[model samples]
Target chain A: MIAPVRVGQAVRLAEWAPGAPIELSEIPANSAKEFILPASETIGRYDRDGARFTMRETTPEGPRTVLLGVRPCEAAGLAIVDAVFNWDSRDEFYDARRAATTVVATACAQADADCFCTSVGGAPGATRGADVMLRLADGGRQFIVESLSARGEELLRSAHGVTEGEAAADPLADVPVRFSHERVTGWLAGQFDSPRWQEFSLACLGCAACAYLCPTCHCFDIQDESTRTAGVRYRNWDACGLGLFTQHTSGHNPRADQMARWRQRVMHKFSYYPEKFGMLACTGCGRCARMCPAGMAISDTCRAIDAEESSPG
Target chain B: MSIAEARDEAPGVRTFRLTFTDEPARARFFGQYRVGMFGLYGLPGEGESTFCVASPPTRTEYIECTFRRAGRVTTALQDRGVGESITFRGPYGNSFPVDAWRGRNVLFVAGGIALPPVRSVIWNILDRRPEFGDVTIVYGARAVADLVYKHELADWQQRGDVRLVTTVDPGGETADWKGQVGFVPAVLEQAAPSAGNCVAVVCGPPVMIKFTLPVLSKLGFAAGDIYTTLENRMKCGLGKCGRCNVGSAYVCKDGPVFTLEQLHRLPSGDM
Candidate 1:
């Protein structure tokens, strides 16, 4: 099973052995995006012979795997990216990985200040993207397993447990709704030129940590790495916060400043993504807030936008 | 694809005439190719750079791409020999609706490096000349040296079927310069091609476009009749990399081509 475990000071998803200690107090620092859209992957490779070259596409052989202890938000992230990768022309690389993987989400039994799953139409025990759900029961000694899909039922059949009994799961985490996603999205529709974006992004150092840690920030950059005669075209994770994310070769930048970049980050998730994908890009996972070096929080920004929207002008 | 011919357009800018190695692929590409569609041209080690397929699909023997030597990929591309291979992923994005503009005069307003995209449409109309009305090209560059497709510009000038008004920016003209000298917007306004029964295609730097749109509007060109292509930075060119979106529209999928009316609907600040 691939579950979250402590490595030095951070919790990351790694192969788990039976009876190994698992970190369940907090979500993994790295989201489940790594399992599907890897940080760097070769999309194509080419070989050159003087002036002529031959190219071949690198097909992804997606191995069967299970996400053992991911949270609902983490599981939902894969589904959000699924819409984009499959839209219009299907990205076979992402599709292959997504099809072969099964999600086993554990319902949150505790909530921290950095968690806000309830605000974005997700909840502690939501089964939106999970194939199987594991709820804690009997004071963390037992799990009330619930199969949500055919994959979940198949997964349960491979388990060692023989007992067929029902048990009441522990109380789910008490996460308060920080802001209305609808209100924030609606307010953002009319606030593209608002000075508040500059205010919200003043402390931002243009570091893309928020995007890297985010489960659903799926922007990527494609480049070639090679050694003269041969090369591999690779797609790597990229973010809107970076200065060069939208810069043209002619030195013109559409989103010229950090304020515009910050606004894009927010508007893409809240308004544009929803208008296109029919779902918010954000899952209300507070990893961006939790990991930001400048102490910026998307939730706080949304809250402030909502406050402004609710106030008299 | 192999580079069949390479020509220097201006300093730091070049044009490559590429031919597909596979005959079936060539047939398939031309089958789907349209004016205003772009391609991703690349070298094995330098990655891909996006640009318009400069030559029109009407000329199916070869595809031509003009690019300024900027960034790694284009630099490597310009350095390659004539017979060298380059990867091409192409004919992507929405195209100029030339079929819809049949029997209407076509006015092309282009500035500097942006002439390539408009050139495709011009050739498309010229190739099907009987289907279209009068053709007028108002092409401008920052300087006489900066003008691309000098040979093609001379050809358009000689052709009685096409009315071509070439211009360089003020103070950029040479001693032998016969063309007008002014900014593109001012030149376009001065040229004053009849907007009635005409479809205007404009492509240029953002500053040129911003000022030119107003001139186009004042020339009795309706928002719907005026078209321009967006030059948003993109990767993948398949709408998945997520960088090329302006508001909800994926420039790779929804358009690299859009009408002035459509551009007005999008967030102008983002563009």
Candidate 2:
């Protein structure tokens, strides 16, 4: 058996077994984001010899990784972050990692109360960022696999034990559309100073677990750590939930309170990310709601906004 | 060679004049920079600090940057010597829309280390005096010793066309100080000029901006006529590093320069 990597509500992915079942109910705790944008990576290294400084760029060199059992919601999250990493200045490290990975995602069989993929214009079987999409065939005894990308075709071609079979009906979960993402986005654009932000964020303990566990939260920080003569520049994951995110050196914080910070967290994902990248920054996986320490639910926030008349776009 | 010259502009701020030992690097640097733009100034092992290009774009011989010794990158920059090589990544963000203000009265308001950004435009306008109309500069610092560009201020004061007003904050003025003695907003209100047919560019800390915006409004300056730059803690001068956003606006990409009206439209006042 291959080493299994378990994530999101104890969802596990083991080595392929022809008759074995795939975990389709639980959303994985960790995302395929680790395969592309790792938690920590060194971008450059610098050393000083006497009075001279010499620096070397750190290039990506790692084994080609293949991720299996990624849900459609989880897979789609990668595409949102991709727009940012490749937007203005192309991040070679992310590019290199992206080129080296192959993703195989599974359609969901069931969704919980927290799941709202349909609300965000995603379906349980959406094939957005996956190389290949798999659906349960022959009553969970076999997977009806279809190639979605050139990489998926290549992987399927090189496989040893697979046999061609008719496409099975996708057993997608019934994920109700709780709110219209566009409507929520429109409402968020005008609700910057709304009291709902305070009301929604009242129970927030300032723990950043939501952003940490989110599949699409891609903010980062760059720093340098050095010895007497040598140093390395590292880019690490950062979240907007922290108080220090926008604090200036002059001891002034633009985001002065939890209300503003929490407002940023929601606005960035719902309003700003869509405006800039033309895609919502959320994947509707509901991991944030499931894992929130304060019981803060993103679905509740979306519904609250959806209940109001949105600003005319 | 590095650090050709350095001067203490204030208690914690220092101005560094630097040169590139590499010919092509220096050539590339001059070609890319514009007035009111900033650079990601750094040491190789120390990381990068964001600050405006203090030297005027007209003077292309070398670049100057003024920064307060704060945070890791600024602290490392403060320790560098004359011959040390520094890593520079830009001339990033938008430039001052100086050409648009041609033949119009131009007012520059700056405070403390914020003068570096405005200083570039100041010299740019001053270099071509006939291209603009009346040029007025109102600057203030926390204290008398905190004032920067003392020589340049004196030079502007002596000029035939330029009007310069310098001030020190309350309790900050020395007994011998002759400039206005109050906050910049109060001093500006007292020295209010006609807001008609003019453009105002203001740069300072947030509190200074908060108080000064209303004063500019009271002076009859339209929201669109006032421009200001924002400085957020930034890593990538490009929008990729991602911390410099306020609302949907990425300060690094969408702005470092924004009009008051443009800022008014943002979803939040966090900026």
Q: Count the backbone clashes (under 3 Å) in each candidate.
A: 0, 5
A204-235 in candidate 2: lDDT tens per residue? 77787888788898888887888768888888
lDDT of 2 at A17: 54
lDDT of 2 by residue, B21-57 (tens): 7788788888877787787888776678788888887
Using all chains and alpha carbons, the TM-scores for the candidates as numbered come to 0.98, 0.93
Stretches of model 1 off by over 4 angstroms after superposition:
none
lDDT of 1 at B83: 82
lDDT of 1 by residue, A1-313 (tens): 6799988898888877788788888878888888889999888898877656778768885878899889988888888989999889999889888889999999987778988889899999888889999999888889988899999989899988736797777898999999888899999888888888889888888899999999899999998887768888898999999999999988888889888888899999999999889999988779999999989999998899889988898
Q: B133 in model 2: Cα distance from truth in Å?
A: 1.4
Candidate 1 lDDT tens digits, B1-271: 8889999999998999999989999999999998999988887777888999999989999999998998888888888978888889988999999999998999999999999999999989999999999999999999999999999999999999999999999999999999999999999999999998999999999999999999998999999999999988989899899899899899998899999999887889988
How high is the CA lDDT of each candidate model?
0.90, 0.83
